[model samples]
Target: MATKNNVVAFQYPRLTKENYDKWSLIMKTVLGAQGFWENVEKGYTEHDVAVMLNQSQKEASQNERKKDKNALMVIHQGLDDDMFKKVANATSSKQAWDTLQKFFEGVSRVKKVRLQNLRGEFKKLEMLDKKSISDYFGRVLNIVNQMKRLGESMQDCRVVEKILHSVNSDFNHVVVVIEELNKDLESMTIDELSGSLQAHEQ
Candidate 1:
């Protein structure tokens, strides 16, 4: 068993002289036992490969656009909602970015503390791998088809069709952003997308 010390001296039956002596000897036999941080530092620096990996991980983490991902996901997920009701409605891009960053910061903090408790809930979910662009486009096509059907039913079908066309254009713009992100991901040193997914969870 391990214990964290908060005081120089404290009464403890568990620290009886005999057990204390044995524990002290045992601890000394352990490598780099001067302090817990010494052990932690040693562990993180043990091998050259490990050191390089850690450096890369840190660099990747430094460039993470976690907050950006969260905002994009938020906007995409909120597409069906009235835009005027969202935080982005009244704010400039900079202001909206700040707000979204704050929101995700809190979200990330909450997740950090409880991830262990929640990890199991995701263990049983099946992952869907990317099949084909056409398969991906199917959902988008479905929406287009639905809009076309709705446009036909309206008395002002032309007006409704125009609205659908505008929506399709917007979808195209979003697709461009998605494609840019995907391409940027390939050359990027680290998986900031994963950070963004973490933000999504947030």
Candidate 2:
């Protein structure tokens, strides 16, 4: 820990007077220590600040783009937990496919937002699940497949995560219904056959 007074004071035991002078000269040539405080005091104008902000925004956008692209690569490699979960818990084969579709659409919209930002297009962002589950899922699949073809990063889409459990429940219900239906049909057929046999005997 350095004391406040010692913060600006630095000394070297190994440095000779001549070596210190030479180091100073080299530092002056390599570093902008010469005008350091003087230039800083001059400061920047509001316009200059704005320009800097714009440039920073651009840099941030570029970085985001690169990150998104890399993320897309990871997505392309395989299905993530969210996607797998959605597929596994699908109420029906159709629902599972629909879930995939919506997820991809969300990803595309996110990419589009990034691109729009980069292009300086300032538009209000709409919520992803602005539509009904069925419609949204359809749209989502459309977007997902499109992005998938283009190659983008994908992750566990929390969008449908909440509904996954419900979908699973529905699937189980369907299974139960089918089983019940089969049992009921079998019982009815047996009863029908017995009644007809008794009637023939009478």
Best by TM-score: 2
Worst 10 residues of 2 by lDDT: 37-46
Which candidate number has the best lDDT?
2
| Candidate 1 stretches greater than 4 Å from native | 1-84, 117-202
Error of 2 at 187 (Å): 82
What are the models' TM-scores?
Answer: 0.18, 0.21
* Regions of candidate 2 where Cα sits further than 4 Å from its true position: 1-82, 121-202
Query: What is the TM-score of candidate 2?
Result: 0.21
lDDT by residue (tens digit), candidate 1, 26-124: 433331232332222222221344455566776654333343333333333322343223444522323343344455556556645555333332232
The sequence of per-residue lDDT tens digits that candidate 2 reaches over residues 1-202 is: 2357557532212212223335434433322333322222232222334455566877765654454343333222234454466456543323433455566667667767655453331122122433433543444444444544444442323212212222323244543543455454433332342333234325
User: How does model 2 fare in lDDT?
Assistant: 0.38
| Local distance difference test values of all predictions, in order | 0.35, 0.38
